[model samples]
Target: MYQCEHGGVVRLKLAVDPDLGPLAAELSSLARGAGLDAVGITGAEPFGSTRRHLEQRKAAGLHGGMHFTYGDPARSTDPDRALPGARALVVGARSYRRAAPAPPRGNGVYGQVARYSWSDHYGPLRDGLGVVARHLEANGWQARVLVDDNAMVDREAAHRAGLGWYGKNTALLLPGKGSWFVLGSVVTDAPLPPTTASAAGGCGSCARCLPACPTGALVEPGVLDARRCLAWLLQAPGTFPIDLRPALGGRIYGCDDCQEVCPPNRTEDRRHPPPPAGDEDEPWVELVRLLERTDAELLAHLGRWYIPRRQPRYLRRNALVALGNVGDGGDGRVVRALVDGLAAGDPLLRAHAVWAAARLGRGDLVAGLAASETDPEVRTELAAAGLTG
Candidate 1:
């Protein structure tokens, strides 16, 4: 006997036969019905190759202090670590693609947000996976859901499940579907058969994503150096790299240049136009407004994002960089934000503020602080900007 709940209604189906094919099919259907765009199953064998890649990358400093999967490659690559006796993985991908909204018309400079972070897509993805997990558990099988979590290497699981191939950008590109999806899985003890047919194609000869990378983070096919990735740098702690700050452009969080240029992604968008962004989607943020917010206000607005050590200052740090690149120095509001940032008590903020002011041709604004600035890091920025004689 198997039982599952959908839309607050309990449904039961008899599984008289010992075969698990029917169960797997039903779970896939449930996942799709629950809003997942794709679903596939794969064995729970450890991702040994992936573990080696992570270890090698971390050793080479390609991870750029990223601690997610790199923090514990062994633990992250092994599904059994997530759920003991795990025999299969039911992977799901929820599409995050949507028609980008027109840039908000406002008085302040706007910072671009990566498509994935525009909304809480992961929350819905988890709910969809939960539906499948609950079904498995109701049938007396142990099931655990992992989404955007370090417990499992989701892309590897998705690839093995025949969901997609690895793109040069290191994203799982679904056949005809592109890479604009968030992936997750339900690690379970069930002995479901894996998807036999692999995603029909590979990224052969098309290396558009490589040069498309603003910072050359995609050093080679299917490899990314996080140290130079604008997406990672925005979330990274400390000062944004001085050399890469100009390329940072107006992005306050995440970078999509690679996928934006991928042939498959572009084609997908043409064939199946995505729906308009929802009201809740935040594709752009006002830089001056964001800088003006109080600590509590900033956190309340963007707390869902992965702020380094959960500090609000990092958010301001990013905004300051974006302001430097896009903010109009002539705009009084922009100057006010830079002024606030330069005057901030935290040296980290003050240092980035100095860079922003100088980049916007407002070096005069930093002159006043040069005499009084004592922090070594801020002093370095001042000297680099030539604000200090």
Candidate 2:
């Protein structure tokens, strides 16, 4: 017997019967019918190799202070930690792929958003997994849905379920389907038969994604130095690194350079074109407007995103860096945004704004402010830009 999170005890039973295979098939169908693009089952064994990899990488500092799966590899890799007496995992993937929207033509400089974040893809993925979990519960099995949660390593679970192989970019690539899907799992005590095989193909000799990384974050196949990854950097706390700011281009959140160059992803796009994005998709954000938003407004707009400590200033800091890369110095609105950033109380924002001002050739705006700047970090930025001696 195992205790569930809701304070209920469930007797653990191995459903070792002829019906296990058919049950797995039925669950798969249920998952697909509920909107999952891909679904498979695997045992709820601890991901031993994945735990070792996480530990080794974390020890070597490849995790770059990231504390997701790396934070507690043992607990994350073991499905039992999520649900005691867990016997199987029903993994599901939902495709978030969509045609890129045309770049908006506007007065304000726009910041590029990564594809996965164009909308809340995880919500749909979770909804699909919830369907499977509900079915298990209705069958007198204890099931818990895990999506984008640190309690489980969903990718390894997907791979173990024969969903896909790990791409050199570290994304799980499904056969003929590419890596444009978000993954989730339903951990349950039901003894379901595992998938018979893994994804049919592997990355083979292709290494295109390694060099395609804007910041060389891949380091090598299947390994990422999160310190240099733009996606992780955007979500990391404190100031964005100075050296990586330029390569950041106009990206305010996440980066897709690696996946954008993957041959399989490109092939998938050409073969089965995704539907064009609708007006609801936010592929771009106006930098000036983002900078101008109040703390409440900013949080309301991007509350779903993983902002460090849920602070809105990180958004502004990212916007300032993007503005520096793409904003026209001659534009009054651009200048006004930078001025507001430079004068803002947050030293982090002021520093990034200083860099943006200098990048836009508007050092005159920062020269006067640097003399009275109290923050050492802001002064350092002014000094680096030659705005101060």
Candidate 3:
């Protein structure tokens, strides 16, 4: 049984054409030559399981207003939505996991960023997928390259392609390689042969990932409540939830706790060689510097990510929380950050600053802020934190 993207299960009849074997072989070679770590093919069937999961979770409010695949599951789960005549999907994986890089020298307060965000993994993955798409085009088949695209469910494509299995964390884990790889695919009208087999999963009784979450975002095996997820919340607009602030800790963007605790990922991490530039290449952002940058400067640095409506305040919002958690209240730099946050234009930023100021136990700072605070929200923050004069 092969999965098609549009709410239907279809078998990719291998006997449709004998030449598919050679074509598949050539495509895989092209992908690897172009720098992809893994490549495999599967039918463009709608990922029924993925669709069901998304629908169920959204209905339960577990999606937390997340629209990615949930905005319209039927479209995202069906490969055909990406291309009308799609017959097969060629999934590719690229490794973004690098050896831990040391923090840049001289920092007041440092916050952690997920490994995937440290560099643009999708750029290389897209380039590699393009190589195969060109090959298919040369062979007279319509091919569309999709990586990090909202129109497709890439992990389902990879799973059906035999490249990996679903780990408890909902990540597609490549056997022996773990969940450190980024996945993408080429959906085409060509009826390529599906891979003979998928990588058998090694996860047995292990459930370490569930408990590894700081906020228990992973509610059950492979199921996540996006409302509680720090990664999504960071990119999510508006105020950072007060209850979850402590769990957010020093993470400015993305949370890798589940993957960090996975046995397979850890084992492979130990054996694999570190990234070329070491930890220095990793973009471990300095918390205090966030508020210092102008909108243009901040955009130039992190334009790659999905900021809340492309606004810089969301980035500053996350940094404010990080600064509150890891920053030294005694440091003059931290004092300036708190002060600047109080003067910010956005109510969201102002509200978050209130939380951060309270977290740092900057009572004197908050007391001074109380008198001048006009925003009802900020006033509530001051009173709640006992900063009321």
Candidate 4:
């Protein structure tokens, strides 16, 4: 028999031909052997709450330029949409808890990347999931697998599979193991052992994650307003809402304040090496240097860590703001980079540069960039920054 809880249905039944348990167990063993902390089976169904939240995130324009998975709700939520006969989902989580270097002092000059992004999660996680999918398919089960790329609400699947519970930050936090893990799933026709109920949250009225968000993006327990989130800010393209830029501080990559304050996360064992002391590859960049990077150089550097899917203009804009925040305007190098980026196309970058130059009391530089500027919109922005040549 099966049960429906949390607005979804669950069933426990034998796989086809009733001889599937041994093979499924073997598949589970292989996944664990591959460095995954946990693997469990869940019944296929739409993750209702997660889907609704995702829709709300998009509708509120909180998704910014991150529209790839936002375009398809059914395909993202319903496993059946991925595989017609998919009756079960095999969910897995790989722990990535590594110690981080202490953040640099004062101006928040060197912000940290989120733990999951600290390593190349996709290739290894997908490889392991694919291996499990193959094992199931070899046993005549139709299987399809995916990691963060798909339209799936992976955190909910992890919870459903008894791997973890959603913390106040909306991340899946496994007991004693923390939330620094990457999640993946395989959908298939095989009926496997249903996972036990996941542990209820251990947060217990803790508000550590809430106050730590520089932009107050947490909103409330288990709810997030991505509009104000620094995580979204770094990846957002096009025009940034004026209100969000200052809150970004100097974070050039992603935000980690919330996780850094969490008790469990603080104690977790970090297996990866510490980040570099100073290099082009360090997590946060001096806004001035980022603006200096050519499009090709920026692409090469960011592609090593981030997926450069959005328009490059947003990243450059962010770099400009970071420069302003760090008070790096006195440097001739930064001034030169701003001049170069201003000279280049991309009205978005020009506008941000105007704002940055004004904040740095460099109206003269703005005037200089505006002198040869042919774009009417850019001239308007320069004028708005109190620059006229």
User: RMSDs, each prediction?
Assistant: 4.7, 3.4, 5.1, 6.4
Runs in model 3 with CA error above 4 Å?
1-16, 276-280
Query: lDDT of each prediction vs. the true structure?
Result: 0.91, 0.90, 0.85, 0.72
Query: For this target, which candidate reaches the highest lDDT against the unseen true structure?
Result: 1
List model 1 lDDT by residue over 1-389, tens digit each: 24445534332232122478889999999999999999999989899999999999999999999988888999999999999878889999999999988888867699999999998999999999999999999987889999999889999999999999999899999998999999999998887877775748799999999988989899999889999999999989888899999999999899999999999988999999998999899999998899999999988999888899999999999999999999999999999999998999999999999999999999989877998998999999999999985
Q: For residue 293, what is the lDDT in candidate 1?
A: 92
* Model 2, CA-based lDDT: 0.90
Q: Per-residue lDDT of 59-134 in model 3, one digit per residue for the tens? A: 9999998877788999999888999878889999999888776666784688898989887889999999999999
Question: Where does candidate 2 have its weakest 10-residue lDDT segment?
Answer: 10-19
Worst 10 residues of 1 by lDDT: 9-18
Q: Candidate 4: lDDT over CA atoms?
A: 0.72
True lDDT of residue 191, candidate 2? 87
- Candidate 3 displacement at residue 330 in angstroms: 0.8
TM-score, candidate number 1: 0.95
Q: Which candidate is the best by TM-score?
A: 2
lDDT ranking from best candidate downward: 1, 2, 3, 4
Candidate 4 on 211-256: residue-level lDDT in tens? Answer: 8888888888977777787777677655666667777676667777
Q: Please provide TM-scores, in order, for all candidate models, with all chains considered together.
A: 0.95, 0.95, 0.93, 0.83
